[model samples]
Target: MKNIFILAFLSVAIFSCGPGSKTIGDTSSSEIATNDTIKIANEALEYEVIIVEPGFDSWLISQPPRGYYGQTKLESKNRQFVAEYNTRVLNPTKYSRNLYTEQINYDAAVDYGYEVNYLLYNYFMYFQEKYNEKFIGGRN
Candidate 1:
């Protein structure tokens, strides 16, 4: 089981960081806010996509190409990301939630995209009760 998990993580990391991979937004020492958006290369395509969120700079730095075959452990993120996304989006139920749906297509946004969206969405939602900025468009 562990080997399978490791193999899967290796595959995602390899494919993600390959030729089409892109690192965006907080690539620097400084951090970005919830409303900031940046364009980055797509993992499966040649074109770039926009990601509107924050905190990704530090999060990505902590992850690895050190897990499973010296690659990012992206495979482990889906279950967690999906769960958080579903909860934040207020899905009718766990089974009804689909991360790849047209409205919240995480695959098109890519793993990093999905991750940042989840983070931004939850952050904005948590803060909107006190702050009125209403960052509504960044979610996956």
Candidate 2:
């Protein structure tokens, strides 16, 4: 009886700790890449692409609050391109502004890689139309 119990416990423990057993805070590289691609593509399509981090917020937060923030990743010929975008409140002092950021990733070999900039542009346009009175701006 003792031997059987030990064997059963060991078997359970081994099987429970298999390859698919992910920790609580485990973030995969694939997920990160995908997110990066989406962000880059979205930003590229909507607003001008600024490689600098500080510039990211500036572009999004304009004088009168025109656009929002976004980001994405792109895989081209085994290379990766991370895209980002943001909306700026043209006149932050005068009006309240909301800031947002997003991103996506795709396989380098795949022709249909994700475009974060385009997605961001569409998202910003949608929100701009939805909330015409409210202006948004911030750094990300």
Candidate 3:
């Protein structure tokens, strides 16, 4: 059996080698709350998607609710986003290494369910808006 594991360690923090520090978004580093971790694991399928980023939980809640988009739509979008994100991961010099920390292994044939797809899709949107990045073309 092939074990499929997808772990995405994306962060909102900016590192600088200077006197002052840099931050993402409006809120400063101090004002921003603790990091949020959103994980969806399917024991039967032996695959999971873990997203650890600051303010993702609240941001996700503010977005459209589950079932807002069909599973196939979400999967399709996720596939595109994952492909672009992985490309960025490979070229850290071109892209921000902090944002694209790791590569995500998303299989199109695998049925990751609604919950997993929903969270994964939202996370990509959040990352794009927050970091000012456009993974795929067209609408987010």
Best by lDDT: 3
**Per-prediction TM-score to the true structure, in the order listed:** 0.28, 0.24, 0.72
Candidate 2 TM-score, C-alpha based: 0.24
Per-residue lDDT over 72-91 for candidate 3, one digit per residue giving the tens place of the 0 to 100 score: 99999999999999998999
Ranking by lDDT: 3, 1, 2
lDDT of 1 by residue, 1-140 (tens): 99999999999998888556446632443435433455556557444545444554344444332332211323234334444554556744542333223233445334454444444334334334333423334223
lDDT, candidate 2, 1-140, per-residue tens = 99999999999999888788677657576654443332333343343332323223334444233222222221221132222222233445544544333333333333433343343343443444445533234111
Task: Kindly report the root-mean-square deviation of model 3 from the true structure over all alpha carbons.
Answer: 18.8
Runs with alpha carbons beyond 4 Å of true place in candidate 3: 1-35, 138-140
Q: In model 2, state the lDDT of residue 133.
A: 31
What is the lDDT, from 0 to 100, of the residue 33 in candidate 1?
Answer: 48
Model 2 misplaced stretches (Cα beyond 4 Å) = 17-25, 39-140
Q: What's the TM for model 3? A: 0.72
Candidate 3 or 1, higher TM-score: 3
Q: The CA-based lDDT of model 1 is what? A: 0.44
Give the candidate number with the greatest TM-score. 3
